[model samples]
Target: MTVPALYRGLFDDAALFPPGDLPLPEAVPAHAVHRTAWYAEAVGPFLVGAGRLAELTAVLAGAPLRVALVLPDGAGQLAPALADAGALSVAGVELADPDVRAAVTALDGQLPAGVQAAVELPRGDGLPAALDVLAGTPYRAKFRTGGLAAGAFPTETELAGFLAGCAERALPYKCTAGLHHAVRHTDPATGFEHHGFLNVLLAAVAGPDEKLAAEALAERSGALLAAAAHDLTDDQVRQARERFTAFGTCSIVEPLEDLAALGLLTAPAPQEDR
Candidate 1:
């Protein structure tokens, strides 16, 4: 099945990250399989932290793996990580630092040609300043939508503010953590409220209106959200995706299941068949 342009490269494979922490040895082969699946267009590059480059390269045995290198320790690790990424196709780079200015300064002219970079901004008071710093550069923005702790998830109002800020600057952005599903719903086991990836797409479609974006984010009706998404014009879809970009998800299968259930994607075959 041909994935829609809006959903193509939407789900970055983060199987190596927490919650799904599949060992690198296993994760590499699993990622290779995902890249060849029917829904391959929906999958983006594999995400690996800078610290794990050695371990990742060791397991590859010369097999090529595309990756979004994450530098959680801050900009100081960017240089050595890139230097160490032998044979790994570094498609993108992500840096999470409280000092957004410093991070931007450190990342200036550091990446190879064509490798995109995203600065994970700190939420709340300093967010605007961070976005302002990134606005002057080519690097995109990254937001943390959910995490292991309940506190890691941003409220609709907070996220709406972020969407608005980025839209105002015409800055592109991506999201990570807690967006395991495609629609807004409460996790039954942990009771952690997770933001739906579709809701976020709709919110981005809402543009710079924080109130409308927040309303979109808060919408839980699957049919309503799916209908809105389906009704989007080709240009609207382009504009929304241009600003929102993609998100990191641990389980590619779960998202495929959600999209299929919403009628956004054809139901994929069983795990064994895939």
Candidate 2:
């Protein structure tokens, strides 16, 4: 299950989200399986909603689990909730708050030490301001790459601008939603065009200008994306990862399978995946 160094800790388990909303009972063990998989190095922390803290605690009992918190209902009770879940190690937090400044202020006040945070910015005129607000803070930027419907996905132009904004600010970021495959492709069933994770990875690494970035995101060829990834030097890959970080996926295997298919990652030995 060897993967390019650029993809280490790239897939954060989001099995609790839509499209594959595995119940805690099912998701907990499935995440554990991913933690031990042959390509386990590519897997990041388990994403759990702030409200689901108690349920996750119950599922784990006394065992410790690495987690990235999602504040779907704002940042209410986040500190207390994490305090109560002594068995869970906090890796980071992600949330989309309309009042970016206030939310970041409150986060700085309540966020525990050593726990990283990301604030999602809308794909609109306010993005610049939001990124500006985050410029000096420890908080990073987050963007939504795709969703269930066509409307849920950002256009190539919009996505490219977002990447360019982050690159200009030297802000590290993460992406969630709609990136199911390694290369951009239109889904036949939904007629929705999904951005590819590999495309985004390369874009972040190169920090291309807006036009070139948009072109990269719109690329549908797996070979081109893989070749771009292969061309990057180790330092460039590391720099790109520092900016791109990881992305959330409903199923960890999907990304791994896609990488294997694209020859970016080596397939596991038969029966070795388990």
Candidate 3:
């Protein structure tokens, strides 16, 4: 299965591998991020400006990259910061406000050849509608992403609704933030506890029966792929929770080594992907 690495690209460092390495196996770096007025004041618009966009594109052009460029899906205008960025294949819409429709409509075909129009389901039926429109065109299906703005992780039922919606629509989705750990582990790097949001893999395991799938995901307190997350008793769950919690990405000692061995993330995937 192809696992797309969810990148919260705030850090200056790489997420999946060492910074200097270009390719690794079975992982695609997702390089989309957001900016705020406060951020501009703190870091300056130069990083979020058009020049930055061009530079970003150049860096990822051959890196098996799926970059999520945040278009100001509000004013219905591509920020001058993005105007000269030149050819983005994946667009991650920031729907903190409810102006997504206007934003995408304004882009129309200007949204690069084969570019995806990702709409966060902030409000209304816009995302489904937008996905439907993008699918009929030559463009690949737009991504159904974004849920972190709500301040709390999704409840089991809410997540179940999302999974059911994805299955019904046949859309493949990905996420960021709150999902930093490989499993339901604490950030060994930071002492704070992270909510285990591993329902992603359980949806894969349990298939499409929503209730069965949801119950399947909710039962685990760790990454779903690990042996510990498999079918278990309440007593086992209670006792194993601490053990299931991972210490850090350091625990990823081997698989990452294997991906590096395969040279997966370096050069871009061949033409079929492009």
Candidate 4:
């Protein structure tokens, strides 16, 4: 089955930081391989940190590269950084800082045309104010799905609230971290629970209703999630993607392999025309 339109361009390569932290040279080639992989369509741009922008340019040696840049905390000038990275296209920028609002506001007039931005908001009392500010801007929202520790993962309630707020405001968002697999499950070593990308996709498609979305985020049944994914009509898939966008993952192969195992992508499923 072929990967659906809802999931195409879902996994952004984030091998440069955190858990995977592959070397820049190694990651550049790996990203090249992924762009040619059988599941290539399901992949997105390489996520590179602002600090590594110069390094990435050096490694690619004049080959054109597309990247989603993660800005450093307290960053003030985005244009100067991009100016130094040769042949690098900044597709998106992930901004998370104590002064997120100011930084985003500062970037208002300086951003390259068509370059997207995702602002990561705190998940508590400050959320609404942040959402309110972002709702009026062209920026999209960003959420952290999981981290190295269990505390990094937000509860179902928190996740649901975030989804509902975005839905209510008609804000599109992207997720990063802890979505290594296609289904929700407990990590044997860390014992930290993880959210499934498929589950999140379904929840986004299910609309912003808190109760229903929370259930989808907490769901563990791969078969049920697979069925939901299989049942998506073309337009429904597009609608879901418009809101959910794509997520960042350390390994693109993991999600693709898991989806393939679930038979949701074993062969091309019949398409339904409107």
**Per-candidate local distance difference test:** 0.91, 0.85, 0.37, 0.83
Candidate 1 vs candidate 3, TM-score winner? 1
Q: Order the candidates by TM-score, highest first — what do you get? A: 1, 2, 4, 3
Candidate 1 lands at a TM-score of 0.96
What clash pairs does model 4 have?
1-265, 1-266, 1-267, 2-267
Write one digit per residue (lDDT tens) for candidate 4, span 64-124.
Answer: 7788888756546466666765568778788776666786775686777898888887777
Q: Rank the candidates by lDDT, best first.
A: 1, 2, 4, 3
Ten residues in sequence with the least summed lDDT for candidate 4: 72-81
- For model 3, name the residue pairs that clash: 22-266, 23-265, 23-266, 24-264, 24-265, 25-259, 25-264, 50-81, 185-246
lDDT of 1 by residue, 41-158 (tens): 9899999998789999899888888899999888888888899997789999999888988788878858888999999999889899889989968989999999999999999999
Identify the runs in model 2 with alpha carbons over 4 angstroms from their true place: 268-274
- Candidate 3, residues 1-274: lDDT per residue as tens digits? 1322321221221233221232322222322321221111111011122224555556566543334444434534455534655454343322222554454454563555544444344423455555444333322222222222433355455555555555555544433334443333444655433333344444433434678656744553433344433454455443322111111121122323322333321323556754
Counting clashing residue pairs in each candidate, in order, gives: 0, 0, 9, 4
On the 0 to 100 scale, the lDDT of residue 169 in model 1 is 93
TM-score of 2: 0.94
TM per candidate = 0.96, 0.94, 0.47, 0.93
Q: Flag the better candidate by lDDT, 1 or 2.
A: 1
Off by over 4 Å in 1: 267-274
Query: Against the hidden true structure, what lDDT does model 4 obtain?
Result: 0.83
Which window of ten consecutive residues has the lowest lDDT sum in model 1?
265-274
Better of 2 and 3 by TM-score: 2
Q: What TM-score does candidate 4 reach?
A: 0.93
Give the winner by lDDT: 2 or 3: 2
